[model samples]
Target chain A: MSHPSPRRTRDPARKQAAILAAARAVFAERGYENATIREIARRAGVTHGLVVLHFSTKEQLFVAATTPDPESLFKGVLDDDVTKLPERIAASFVHRMEASDGADPVIALIRSAAGDQQAAKALLQTLQQTAVDGYARVLDIPDLATRVNMMGAHLIGVAFSRYVLADGPVAAMSPDELIARLTTTIRTILFD
Target chain B: MSHPSPRRTRDPARKQAAILAAARAVFAERGYENATIREIARRAGVTHGLVVLHFSTKEQLFVAATTPDPESLFKGVLDDDVTKLPERIAASFVHRMEASDGADPVIALIRSAAGDQQAAKALLQTLQQTAVDGYARVLDIPDLATRVNMMGAHLIGVAFSRYVLADGPVAAMSPDELIARLTTTIRTILFD
Candidate 1:
């Protein structure tokens, strides 16, 4: 077996990071259906082989690029004081919107899932494992699962209006307004 | 100009209705991207010319087929007693889900809007003209527009979870359960 050359081995981690960032941009711009791996590879300035090596398929790449670190997000939300949990959750969502500069993975996943079965599965799985299960695990209340799911539904709608549709009053609100509007309702969904 | 024969004189209204129904099914099954006018014509048993004659473009047909009569829906929702208005609104949503037999036009619109700009515009316009404006016109409250928009956002999210995602606890709820869960929250968003 031939050993890899120094050029091939040099800064693999940096190359992987570059590919992920490129994938996110391409997915956001072209959407899931129109987004291509070759385009992603070209944008990343990496060979097609390298992109394939890092991400076996476009679906996997799409998921990886669009999905937030659900674990970290939920953990941070839950780790806060219970009285402040809703505020923290709202803040985290705003932080995600700001961090992504409006290319939110959850919104992307929802948009792609609108037409693609695989994306739909990824969306359901992500929400279930992240928001629904994450909240249910910590909060003990009657009809917790249903309430959490409803909360997820509400947030998904808000995201759709503000980000996807990008019109109407919900879309017009500032980030501070968004957080203010959502915090009370989110609290109501979880606790009341 | 040549006079049309009796064979060409079939009920125009009936034919238009058939085409719209076929368009809805095709759009629902194939979504906006993959759904074809040709297939819709075939399903409707009309010539492609007839389909085009009725709806000039796929986008037009998509808008027509997927958009509920916002005027009627909101009029009906608003005409009721103010005390039971929330329950009526919730019931109307459930009634829509039931009437469509699971191929919900609003959900289809939301799903398509996720990836398509025109659909996004349609979703926004429909919500703004129908729900936001309708509610704001009827209810005199502080921040009425923002409150109504938030209410729209919440309903859109609930519809997404229950219909599009189809796997969460919200999805598993019965129609009555859905109405019961949604009524209180919607009331809160509008009134509180």
Candidate 2:
């Protein structure tokens, strides 16, 4: 029997990704409480049922949308070489955030979390478990959790000011300058 | 001439102060766009007409509310003694923020500005002219604006995480630890 054409088959992975991309956009614009499944589906050019099938609920979709793929985002930044890890991580983070065409998912997550206690708790737990814990494990330093936490606060603060808030001097700075300047502060946190 | 009973006489300054205080609380709670004059008037225990007479419009009220009293907040942090400026600033900021029983006007301004371009622009301008310029004047460094900007980002980031987002480790950090750790990072940004 002749197999159906590959193009004719619906790729679940591709469909899910489309839904997530739309969800991210919607969530970023409207925040979690205001974003609706129908709106996300409309943005994705998919049926509402398809989105529901993939994400099950708005909270599920939100969690999926806001959650960063830490491995991909931090590629090699958390590796064996603890030296320059701060610089590398800061560079990678700023690069990723600046590369985004619209609101960064982290900013969206933060904005959404600000209005919702439950979402905020989940977001913090996810960050602690994923990024913070990963950094601690890779670095294997004493009081690594606190270090990672401080590092995150610094990075997020810069990101919030530069990207989210669009502060004048911050937004005016070139990416290289930001990475370089931020690296110095990050280094102190990680090393000092 | 004997002044009429202070309680009966319309003390414009006292009335204005009450209205501004109420505006700050309302703005902090609902943000600028969402906050209403009627609500602010109600909170201030005055008539809506009185609020309008005092501030003219919600926009004006917001500007008034979010504006920090620089002298109270900055104090000696912006003085000629630049050696401990970072530590002093960090300490004063954290102390003021922690001491507040309700939403911080700075945090409220930030959250409120996130969605409003005009508000964001005004906020940035205020910071540049106030905190940044103050630091530049005191520090006398060529790149003092950038340095102060970085310091702001770091302090805001820590404040945002610890107070706004209530990140676990950041919030769990004792005031002394938070101040000490943040002072170190701020020192790097300011002097290093």
- Candidate that scores best on lDDT: 1
lDDT of 1 at A146: 81
Candidate 1's residue-wise lDDT over B1-192, tens digit each? 366432353678877877888888887766677788999888877789998988899889887876777676765788636878889889988887767755567666666764567865775576556666677656777788888778778877777777766676787889998888778888778776
Local accuracy of candidate 2 as per-residue lDDT tens digits, A110-134: 5564344466557656766687667
lDDT of each: 0.75, 0.73
Q: Give candidate 1's error at residue B62 in angstroms.
A: 2.1
Off by over 4 Å in 1: A1-9, A71-76, A132-138, B1-9, B71-76
The digit string of per-residue lDDT tens for model 1 on A120-191 reads 567556765677667766677788878777887888788777777678778888899889878888887878
Candidate closest to the true structure, highest DockQ? 1
Predicted chain A of candidate 2: TM-score? 0.86
| lDDT of model 1, residue A22 | 84
lDDT of 2 by residue, B1-192 (tens): 476532343778867777788777776666555678998877776789988887787777777777777677677677776787868887888888898744566676555643554664576567556787566567777887878777777776776677776767888988988889878888888888
Candidate 1 predicts chain B with a TM-score of: 0.84
Weakest 10 consecutive residues of candidate 2 chain B by summed lDDT: B1-10
Estimate candidate 2's alpha-carbon lDDT, on a 0 to 1 scale. Answer: 0.73
